[model samples]
Target chain A: MNAMPAREQETHILLVEDDPADARLIEIYLEESGFGDWAIDRVQSIHEALDQLAEQDYAIVLLDLTLPDGTGPENIRRIKAEFPDQNVVVLTGFDERVFGLEAVQLGAQDFLVKGDYDENSLAKTLRFSIERQNFIRRLEETQKIARIGSWEFHPDSGRLILSDQVLYLTKPDDNEVKDDVPSAELNQLLRRIHKIALSGREINLDTRIKISGHGERYFHVQCRMTRTSTNQEIVQGILQDVTDRYQTEEMRKARDLARKSTEIREQFIASISHEMRTPMNAIMGLSNVILTGDGVQGEQKQMVQAIRDASDILLGIVNDILDFSAIQAGKIQFREEPFSLRSVCRNLEQILGTKVKDKDLGWKMHIEDQVPDQLIGDKLRMSQILFNLLGNAIKFTEKGQVGLYIELKDRNAEKVELRFRIEDTGIGIPEESQQSIFEDFNRVKYQHKTYEGTGLGLAITRQLVELQQGQIWLESHVGVGTTFYVDLGFAVEPKLTNGHVVNDVLKSSEGAFRGTILVVEDHKMNQLVARKTLERQWPEVQILMAENGQIGLDMLERHHVDLVLMDLQMPVMDGYQATSLIRRHHQARIRQLPVLAMTANAYVSQDPQLHEKGFTDFVLKPFEPEHLFARILQYAPLKAIRL
Target chain B: MSTINTQIDLEYLDSMSGGDTEMRNTLLHMLAEELPKEKDVLAEAAERGDLPAIFQASHSLKSTLAYTGNTEAIRLNEGIEASSRHGLWTAEDQEQLKVLFERMDFLLVALRDLTSE
Candidate 1:
């Protein structure tokens, strides 16, 4: 058959056939097809073909299904099971076309029937088998690199066949499931799929399996079943290790849980604040009434003063706890508005006057010349921070002094960073505990525990300062004293002519407000307090009361009220909705009329868009009479009795 | 425990009231009028497992009793307040409320008598 030679080339071919005539025909066909340089190896039986295949590398094996020693696809399966990438073209009779096609499905590259094609077709099938085998080999090489593997199970033989990659994956475990049989667990899993396959359904499963003597690992497997020509069932599928992806999913779930709990905590704290302040409004409000009531002179007046003091102490504790919780839950909102730094500090000085006197400590507040007249910032929060630091300074100082020094640290045309230094000659924190002093519920142990506080003041102060894009730190000695340094930034605002200082604003109300005022409140005691406090300031000023926003709206329509004091969290339409409605009123003057929102919630001031929420300004409950009066006078300037 | 000190602490009241007898009487009247309603709210909240309500009532009573130096009532209210703060209103909290109610009842009677005098 070697009729021609293509100079210097060698192509080996193995012809596995039992019949002499068939082999000779194949050889003649290949030679006629111009495969002249091919060195063909002829074997009569499957055993001899295997021996020859093991001995040399043949480019293609022309496999005949019928053999003297072996019969059907077993021959093809045995060779492929050993050398999975080996190329084989099945040779069969016309009557055995089905078996030949089955052999191809079992990993043979292509199939051909005797007398079905010419020499050209024979040569084309052979060349195509080699090319297809090379493509499969390269694909398997890539899959192996990506840690993916393939597998097959023959139910008739109860044999599990694994790819090279599958073998490599199990290599780490050194696990051998006894003579190529799957473990009981794996067999049970296969049986389940076998049941599904009975109905011709496919199975896809992602599960974590623990191999004997090996740790747990996750796998994603997709599989289906098919039957051979002999009706023998075979299961084939792919398995991928997905342990890393599984772990990532678990971590993501954990993060979501943490975020959900944080939100719940924030909501809990907000509700608690509301609950606590509602009653505080009653206690403080009634006590103020009793303090101002007639027929209470001498000892009775002193008793009312005591009640007021105790109420103040209780209020302070509640405020501290709420502030700390709010800060911890990241719920503190900050507002930016035009406020004078000088006025804020001076107001703080006056508010802390009684504590300074009670502690018998001298107090000094110094404002640098370079400090801006007005800055756009959360005035209430800025004042709160100063108030907390100064309050603490006063509380700890016994006889020496507490001082606050404010100066411009750095400034630009757009913003200014001011440094607030509050120093006190009082019991100081130790060197080691200084760093952790700002932690929640942490307090330096005093010898006698004489000081009264919730120990949350400093922690809340630090959080508020940080929320404002500022920083706070402290230095202290055990016995000598303590000094806290805070740096905060504020946007510069155009200075208003004759900027109002605390003294001038509080003390210089242009006589009693003589215009009509509307008081919208839900609580009876608070309404009484507002009425009495307003009357105490201006006895002739006409007053109107509304229990809620709905009533408030009705009152505004009927009365010539100059100002509306709106409460935020009231029954049957709250202050926010009422204020919005009022702003949208059909009457231009009524819509433009100022609404001063009065909220028991201190957090209201933290809302950056308070003005947008339809409020001229807001005053917190348990209001200082002077502060409330000033806020009122700002809206309803004093006038001759209503025309 | 036998003689439960239910009387108002004169020293705390003296300091708080600046020794104003009429102010002390006014405070006593307020306490007498409010304490029963506050106690009933706490009891009902505990029975209904309304922890926020229990927490609110306990806090209100605790702040009010702090003015009178009713140590037992204040301590029990603090316990209830703390328990309910975490939304855990249990049988033990109800028992503590009972004890608080007893002590507050005794003090309320004393205050009423003082007001009449």
Candidate 2:
């Protein structure tokens, strides 16, 4: 380290001139001047001067204009161009000011006549030239970092000045030097900073600086105060944006967040596996007991019923999971129409009442008189919301009463609002879990192991409620009770009671065409359910059943059928094929006969396909009685059969 | 920490309405209610066989006994369960009878309450 700063030394010089002599004048001049504490490399000829300049960093170079190898100002020009940063003074025998000026203009610091010049004047010129150059270098450096816009600030203004390259690189910009700034943001940015300064608190401001050339730049301004300023206040520190630096930081943060969520999801999957397998094992064990004890006596049948109920609950939980994913994926569609609110409420009540009794908790419902007897909306989504709320009230409360209170509020010209409040008094939701109530797969904090649920109920409820332009919220105390509220809005369409709603739908829809019915299904359970429900509706109708698409085609070719209830997935061939074939073959009224598809797969978008295949419509495999009944009245009518 | 229903007063267990007649049936009933819970505790212990855990399980059993009214049976089993809990039991396998007696008494009480309800 000779390069260790502050330890470096300036070079000393020897100016050799021999001409009566410019040599004496040069020596005297450098000795007297002491520029930047000193030094010179002087030679009469090019050869010696080259050797000395090459040896060390010469503080200054004194040249004799008249040299043997390079004569006149030619020598000055060559040396001047080469060592431009080096301090050099021109010396000549004649006062040829023009020649001296020419040498000076070519890059020499000063020029002198060999006979006329004194030591002080020559030294002054050399000293001034070096000082001016140093100042210029410092000024150029200060402008570079200050040219970039935007900065990050500390909440408290604390500055730790260090000997880092960045420290010297960063500097304030002088408005005079830079002309290409976004004039608009200057006012806003300053105002924001000033507002922050007045707050006397910590804040991180993201400033988007739109410089003229660079379209837009983002900066994080973190302001911090170290100690008491004038009035026991803190110092605010700003960390300027290095967007180039921030991109990497943002990417790192995103990866970290992704990792955390992935870990949570993995944990959720693990819990699911445990929850599913354990219950299945229980059901399997119980079923074995029931089979073994077959017709034993009083309690044995009860035990069997209990086991069946437990399995049913487990199935329902799994269904909740299916619905949760379906809703989030936007696969759950609304079947728009009119339905009776009272009947829906009664159905929900029957479902909930038995559940509360099983848990040994009280169940109560208070319906508002003003609630329109019936309203039009998506009954499926509405039922999901209602079911979730009721389930929560029952699940959380083990000892106390679980009650539902419904009231109509905010009835306006445009819409009617029906609000339902559910109150439960078992284990109240924790304060921490209040925020997480409506979030997906979020159970109450300090959760119980005994309660079984998919944890998707509340999330589905929120989504469904929003879909209907309704709202849900809750209030609770730790050991007391939690009250949950739901508000639903229905449009200003004509209202119908449950009995009338069904009657009107069926009456208007039923046509005058009695046709033979064809049912196509592969799964035994679905097929049985479909057959039983259809039989209950139309007691005396002749029926033709097919297990797959091929069989269904054969039956259609052979038999005379008015309508078909078709299952989409089958072992041999599918309903899609059967319907397509029946359409393509162009059979008589039998071919034109309405064919309704049954499917469980949520992804199969049936609207376009159903229309394309020339089928009348579709029904999901797990058929509801009313839905099946209503749609049936549309195609094969009782009146037509009578006629 | 020995949550076993020991000191079984067979007369009191037998007095329950519709309680199990055989000792094995009684033990099975108690096992149905308590064993599952104990297994859950063990799963969650994070560090098993610790003094704190044995004490905690016994404490939980004290309430379980109150609910089932099997006080005498709990007292009979308490000594060995507590000894084992303190890590002082020399012969661990020999304590099976005490565990059985406690379970039987507990089952009798549970069956009685269930029948009455």
Candidate 3:
């Protein structure tokens, strides 16, 4: 009676009974039992009961043990399965008291025996059933929303009392559940609880369990020892599923490891390449100095030329590795400046013409008349793309003609796309291998013939082309020929100017160039190479030397130098710190002085903040004599030549 | 394992209705009218080998048999209900159902005589 709804508000009841006479007897009992205020609706079978339940709310459903559609405890299960929140009081006969208890275990709130209970007992049962069912439903909803379950363990009995939520969370098969806990996961949990009870200590931990249908899941468990009102020691705890958050943390850790390994690899390659370049600079620079000097005739000159050629190939391999690393690190930069297409072609012809002639192969250079002479783009990268393609064409061809054909593909007021075709009658590439040709370190072997070069040429070429928003592809026949086509767009320089064309003038002004240059370098051979190379190019110029940046700074203080050729990676002070000092010098003249960085570190060349670091420009080491001279002539204030 | 010494016991109804003989007669008449029809259902379901229907019919009869204090019929019907629930109607279960039907038929005749009195 205490749990019953107030008389002012009518409680609706649904009676599912197949017998009309039995239903009417229950109605008369409800009225006699002081529940006349309640509205009772009757349905004959489980099917009709479900329809009525769906259409309305009921305070309680008095279900007969056997209906036409379903019978026994299964009727209660079917109804509760669909409407878990519904309060059902199983109505059984006097002889079926055992089944009435079974129905309660199967999720019925309570049960009644007909003709055995008085009106007062019937009223009390229905009222208490509704109240108990509501409490169970609230607990279920709370557990589902928070993904948490609670449990109590008794150490003496080795017994566990798990809430309905805990049973759902463990999801044990009917056979796997023993002593009210799942076998595998429960054994582990019981061990922990036993430890907690023995030590009388609270424990917080994470544990992993392999559920039957669900894969491995992680749980956050917190438990402690406590005593009941009866002084019985027990362990109580809560378990929360943290699988999603734990898996995310694991993925983040894996990604960080991958990124860290890539960084270490790039650093290793860079240091190795830097160490190799210093010695190589001495080899290439000193060799050029030897070849350019006035010396003995025929055989001696050719041997020195061979040494120069071998060193050139070695240096090319080193540069290719460094370029590939730079591309992998996403550090390659393109410069937009005014450069003549004609000059780039002329240089290519001069470099490749000798190799073509040596093979007794015909060479052809044709330019479409409509193609512009001047264009604005990254002049260095453009030249590298053309050089890589032409070099490969010459290397693959045996005796056939190597040709470069250029034409204007499309033009606008601001930009023009130029198409370059480098064709060779060589051992052509097969169609099957063409798609993967542009992948890194891929080299094609035709008839078991191996070429002597790093396999990064075409890969670097494609990267450079794509970086500049251009397209490159090829057409080839296995025995007939191979022709590579490149289509690149560039901003047109409306008027030809005096930008990179000054390089031609610098070539002619060789001995006419004069300046007092300071070379700050740590390596003895590199210092000797730099001094001799500078002196050979400009016989009248004076060259000063320093082993480190500190000495270089002192040299700048004592001498009136035109330019400082600073080498990075020195003993006392590096080039970056030395340049900072020079830029911030006490004297206005030193602060205004130009410093050209000569570095073996390829990363320094791609640094966007190079100028901000107080160096005017940088030249990569194993320096080409012509490129070194060009940088020198550009920055050094020569007293003799104004231009 | 209580034996059925009498065909009917009004002690349960007497306690519920406070010894009202009129109400007891009305309930007995209702049981007499419903028990025969339910017994027919159980027999037809057994003839057709329908286990679910047999379970339902026997389950329904056990309650009405409790009002008559027929412990033997109740026990037999419970056995039939259990076998049908397991989806099996073995030879023993069929013999039990036969005994249960005979007991119900005798109970129905006894209820008719009582209602007439």
Best by TM-score: 1
- Estimate the TM-score of every prediction: 0.66, 0.42, 0.64
Q: How would you encode candidate 3's per-residue C-alpha lDDT over A27-131 as one tens digit per residue? A: 777889996578778888899888888887899999998888988898887887677668999999888888898888666888988888777888889889877
Worst 10 residues of 2 chain A by lDDT: A160-169
Interface RMSD (C-alpha) of each candidate? 6.7, 17.2, 57.4
Q: Which candidate is the best by lDDT?
A: 3
| TM-score of each model's chain B | 0.85, 0.41, 0.88
TM-score of chain B of 1: 0.85
Report lDDT per candidate: 0.73, 0.57, 0.76
lDDT of candidate 1 at residue A31, scale 0 to 100? 76
- What DockQ values do the models have? 0.08, 0.01, 0.00
Tens-digit lDDT track of model 1 for A229-326: 88888888777777778888888989888888877676666555655555455456555655665646777777667777777787778778777767
Name model 2 segments beyond 4 Å from true.
Answer: A1-307, A323-338, A356-370, A396-405, A412-414, A423-450, A475-482, A492-518, A523-544, A549-565, A570-597, A602-643, B1-117
lDDT of 2 by residue, A16-129 (tens): 353534565565566666544554444667767766666666555667777777766787666644554556777766757778877765666777776576677776766665
Count clashes in each candidate, considering only residues at least 3 apart in sequence or on different chains.
Answer: 10, 42, 0
Model 1's i-RMS, to one decimal, reads: 6.7
How would the docking of model 3 be graded? incorrect
Candidates 1 and 2, the one with greater lDDT: 1
Which pairs of residues have clashing backbones in candidate 3? Answer: none
